[model samples]
Target: MSVSSHLLFFFSSLGAFNGLLLALFLLLKKDKQYTDNWLAILLILLSVRIGKSVAFYFTPTLDKSILQLGLTACLLIGPCILAYVAQSTLNNLTMKRLTITLSCFTIATVITGILFPYQDYLALWQYWIYRGSSYLWLISLVVASVMYARKNTYKLALSKQLLTQQPVVVLAGSWLIWTAYFTASYTSYIMGALSFSLVLYLTLLLALKSKWQEKASTTQSKYQNNKLSTEQTTRFSNLLNNLIETEQVYLDPQLTLPRLAKRMSATHTQLSQLLNDHYQMNFKQFINTQRITKAKESLKTYPEMPVEEVAERCGFSASSTFYSTFKQQTGMTPNQYRTTEI
Candidate 1:
């Protein structure tokens, strides 16, 4: 092997190793919800895919077998990411059907690959179909994530749940790493896999730090009040009510969980727990409900008010966003709701 190939093998191996570690950590992590499991599986599959790159550059003997394995890994990447995003944002039971459908697609593709396991076919399949699908699925998920974030009253809430960076930001970073890897690997550029490894390592570090922060926050909360007393809970609830009903704080377009918590004189965790335990909604959902209620009144009271202006008055960031959110919440557009109700 040349110097460049040696470098590729070493760095790509490093990335695969880091990814494996991250996957194990996430898999064994207790108390994880749906997104965590999906992310772990994504990491594992990605690790194997990178491992195939290492083999291609370094191990000419085991080329065909590992190529097939890598392509199989590639097949799962899209479906797994789509499932992860759906669970993370929508959190709906219907996503189970989506998962099943994706699984069927992956199985069918794998069966086809097995049936046509020749170098010519495999090369075409991997280069044209699977590689493109991997990037395309990730892009779709990224766009969905961006839309999900923008549609919410608090742009960062969903991101906080998924990644340390905003979902788009993280996905953007992932895309850059992927783009570099794709261009470099296809051309046999020595440094192509290097960027992917380093980015994966950085992501692992960020995820770990985020996890630690969560743990520390939970511990501190447990130590501080050791669970809210009945009186304290009532007081906090009342404060939240005053903030929402009296102050109408949800009218702010930039309303966020941390900001609202500050206004309530409560910790972010405490406020989050309050909503989760009591209202059974996250901050965005709770805030949107309030906004939708107020929007309905405006639409009814002033039928002449433009739908765009109504959305702005209701704290939506964009007119399009407002329409979508309003429709989502009430099952009717603002115009329809106005006509029907008035």
Candidate 2:
């Protein structure tokens, strides 16, 4: 075999091998949603690359038969992998609709290609349409993946970054390979380079997975540091409820940590520590939450009371603090909430 052919064989095999490993890892460790979906996508793309390599080896020329078959597979594989990734990452129905649309498009492309094989001009036109449509769909998938990653509630900061970055990298790499293959002459050198790049890309995905695991570990540690033991949490909750029920703490205009701690029969240091360590919030936020709860009740039951009256009745020192705290907790200002009720 020539040098280029040998390189193609090696890279093609490497791509296939890495893809198989990714697929197996995902299948075995299906507990992680992000890793599983990403691995599945890698597998699909690698499979398509493998098919393309084999097709090129068999067909010496890029004619109607080769173009038809290769383009059809490309169209099918790109969208299928994207849809699966989106579904797995977002866990939503949008992925399902995208998958269904891609599937229908793939079927139509295949039917048209098969039916018009002898009509070379028509076949080429159908091929370009399918390719253009698939490219647009791929771009949409990239955008959706980005939006999902940005808005996802995944607690690990690094995991979110990795999720956001990896998809764009993959899309860029795929575009480069597709552009090189279609715009330039078909050579084993170009094909091999693409295959090798894909292999490297897949290896980077493994790094991403490792980063995700590390982020998960950090998140668990943070959770442990912030969380209170069940017994302590329950005791704190009971004490908080009792303080609010008595209305003594609420009536104190200068309600401070030392005063509240004394009323609860706890030292200032102990109460401050409990509020900070257990609730992951400062004493002010904890107190504001209670005040907001009371204000909400007053708003519903006594609509005739002015907002300022409600704030003062709820133990808030100022209307500005009351409005800010209420909005932060309920995602609406006092006036907006009252309007909603009516």
Candidate 3:
């Protein structure tokens, strides 16, 4: 085979291999909804490109027909796929609307293409118009994906302090791929098509690598946080247990933190520090969680009791305070919660 033929096969094999790898990854990790959808869409694109490459190798004369078909697919389904991937990744309502819009445009383009098969000058004009629309859609898809990736990175960064740089690197790499492929001067169909395929493959590989690294880092951070959180929880649980079981401090309607601290034989400052630093809760929330927990039990078992009586039994000083705390925590007042019981 000639060098050109050899190069075609090489790109085709590489594209198909990448598609199969992505498909396998998706199948293996079917539980992750976002990654699975992305891999699935990517596999579709790769498969199509591979077929195009193979067709190009076997029949050089049908190159224009093949190019037209490939570009048409790219124009029609490319945006939809990108939009779907963006929506899945970000789970954003805005992206959903964008996906819907792209789907509608794809439908319209298909209808137009079918009505006017490109044989004459007018049909050719119509074809180019639709093709331009597809390019515009592709541009939109690229922009949306970049925006979603940036937003996802920002959210991840805000949630964890250690995850500062991974998102930025992924975003930068993606932008670079887009820039290199789109800004090149070689307007030949083969070069353009190959460049698009190369950029997409590289983008997927980098994205998956960045995502895996981010998840690993996130998992580690979560494990550490959970460990620390559990320790705080245990300490608080012990404190509450002592308050309810041994000292019986909940029986005091006016059980302030200072008084409870005195009864627990710890300084008020030390108790306050425990609530704030370890539990990351203020004294009011700590006391109210205990009160509301007790109130829930009372409401469940003592259905005949008045709401006010339940409030008083839970060591709440007033009915209003009990109602407010209950609503704040459960999104409903005590009476409403009781009414919906079971």
Candidate 4:
């Protein structure tokens, strides 16, 4: 390759390499949430797919199996991105539903690959599989966009807050841009990879910015070094318990730490210290625990009640959140749990 060609190769391939590294970091990170796992999977699949494209664009004679592998990764990217965004927004269908959908897609892809290997059916692979995968990816993006819009319709006015609060929107928009470039005949094949590289660096910058803000907030907060004494801890715990059990304050979907603290006649620092020190949970975690507990009881008692209604009654702002949280806590989706109870 010439000097310019070599530089292009390096630039195009850099993103895939960094993406794989980022995915590995996410996988190895401790105390990962479901959203983290989905994001990791999305990154890994995207890296594989992009890597395949860069290789094929440079070396058209790449092995057929390698081509097949890349296309399969491409096919999976649609579902992976959908799941990642959905999980991030807490607006996903049940995990079981997602699993079944993915399994069906995998089975179909495998069967087709076996029946007509890419080497034997190059045209078929080039046309049908390529188009199908691209369409699926577009469909996933459309669906995810609609879901996010519905979830954050009210927050759209505050662009800064939207970027910080829904980083997934920025990521999804980046993915959309890459997809458009990849599918457009006017754009060079390497342009897609370059777009991905740009987005990956943007993601890194956003992540670092968030971390810095968090560190700055902690440094500024008076409660950073605040701790409850044993007696104060006991007293605060009793107050929290009474607020939750007696008042059932967790039923309010709009509840916040400050609001709850005010209600409990305690300062935010005291309430935060109580939850963190005594329960080993943050404010949101503690509140979600109470809500999940209530959901479990409601699920068992009123098996006839719709799961959505149960979720609302138990204080979840969205049924998707309820489904994900209940499964996380109870090892079953609401419907699955209901079936077992029956």
- Give the clash count for each candidate: 0, 0, 0, 0
Give each model's whole-structure lDDT: 0.71, 0.61, 0.58, 0.77
- Looking at model 4, residue 10 earns an lDDT score of 92
Instruction: Put down candidate 2 lDDT per residue, 1-342, tens digits, no spaces.
Output: 789767766665666566667667777774765335644655655555555555556555645565455455555555654654464343223445676776688678778777766245654555565567457546755665575455333322444344334444455455555555555455552463355457457658767885796567446545454445677667866887787776446543346675576556555555666888777778888888777877888888888888877876676655677788899899999989988876
lDDT per residue as tens, model 3, 245-277: 665566445456655665555445556667787
RMSD (Cα, Å) of candidate 4?
7.1
Per-residue alpha-carbon lDDT of candidate 4 for residues 1-342, written as tens digits (9 for 90 to 100)? 999999989988998999999889989999876677877887888788889978988999899999998888888877877776666454234645776777798798889889999999989888988888888888887777786676555445646545654345445654654565566688677787777787888767877897796566556556455876888888878888888888787876656786677666667777888888789999988999999889888888998888877887787867778888899888999889888987
- After superposing candidate 1 on the true structure, give the runs of residues whose Cα lies further than 4 Å from its correct spot: 1-8, 60-62, 120-123, 150-153, 156-170, 185-192, 211-342
* Most TM-score-accurate candidate: 4
* RMSD of candidate 3 to true structure, Å: 14.3
Q: Model 1's lDDT to the true fold?
A: 0.71
lDDT of 3 at 220: 52
Ranking by TM-score: 4, 1, 2, 3
The C-alpha stretches of model 3 lying farther than 4 A from their native spots are 20-29, 46-59, 63-65, 85-96, 119-134, 149-189, 192-342
Model 4 scores what on Cα lDDT?
0.77
TM-score result, candidate 3:
0.47
Clashing pairs in 4: none
Q: Deviation in angstroms for 151 in model 1? A: 4.6
